[model samples]
Target: MRAHLPLRLTRTAAFAAVCVTLAALAHSLGGGTGPDPWAAGVGLAVVFALAMALSGTERSTTTINATLVVTQLGLHELFGGDGSAYVAAHQHGRGLGDALGMLLAHLTATLVTGCWLARGEAALWAMLRRLARRLVLLRPVATAPLPPAAPIAHVRDVPRRLLFRHSVARRGPPLPA
Candidate 1:
């Protein structure tokens, strides 16, 4: 058990290190004022997903994916994110808040896509289910089967007179030819 603990910790650290390295590379490459904020996020996400997939262990994949997410979040926060250009262009040299917001949005998309690619839908759904079960607000609804779809009751027949047809013109006197 003690040996397992060290291994787990090492695995976690390795994952975090990989994420930080990738983040650094991304920052160096395109994390600048002129570059699109999504470029680094997408590049890191793709690389992390491939790495996690190649690891060949579900637990390791999940653990690594989570570590990458948290590490990326911290890095984004620490470095003021990669949206300076956008903020400068739109807000005109605004405060760090907008940059942080952009960082959050980018990281969220990156992490979600990375997790999905690494763990697949089943794993994500299971995690969501577990979270739902644990949350007090969702506990009751988590196990509840979806209510049967409402039956489509037939509408009452409409009176024929109520319907209008262009072919049924009034039988008034014929117009002069």
Candidate 2:
């Protein structure tokens, strides 16, 4: 879907396609009540964009992601989450708080996912830097000295002058009467 986008429109168009796909899937799986048809995915995308914009203006992504994750966890626990008894009791419950919680959860997950992906990219960049240092083409031009190589040794017998004496005769043997 994003492949058709020009170099400039590429990112926007891809996100638009994602929003459309998300809306269609959500509607189908949610039995027409999952979320609003045009609003589900696109809304979240907007939320993500907003989150990114907010981060640019205010806090960092890590802080935002952490805040979202904690909020979502609280909401899930409150709603009788995953398989909890409390969540089961509120399966049909409705309130302003619940609505707000749902909104927060969706936004949090989206932003947190984006943050983690950016982090993954950062790690990849660091690895690429290390790799560049190893490759001759990408390595920095430096005049520094190289490290020493491994040493080699050979064993040889020493002459008598260099060796300790093992002889029984002395220099005075010829002069003895």
Every model: Cα RMSD to truth: 21.6, 13.5
Task: Encode model 2's per-residue lDDT on 92-138: one tens digit a residue.
Answer: 35677876765565565547564764464355446756676669676
Clashes of each: 0, 3
lDDT of 1 at 129: 62
Q: How do the residues 88-164 of candidate 1 rate in per-residue lDDT, one tens digit apiece?
A: 54342566787576566657655764565455534644775677667867445546678999999999997675456
- Candidate closest to the true structure, highest lDDT: 1
Residue 160, model 1: Cα distance from true site in angstroms: 99
Single out the weakest 10-residue window by summed lDDT for candidate 1: 1-10
| Per-residue lDDT value at 92 in model 1 | 29
RMSD in Å for candidate 1, one decimal? 21.6
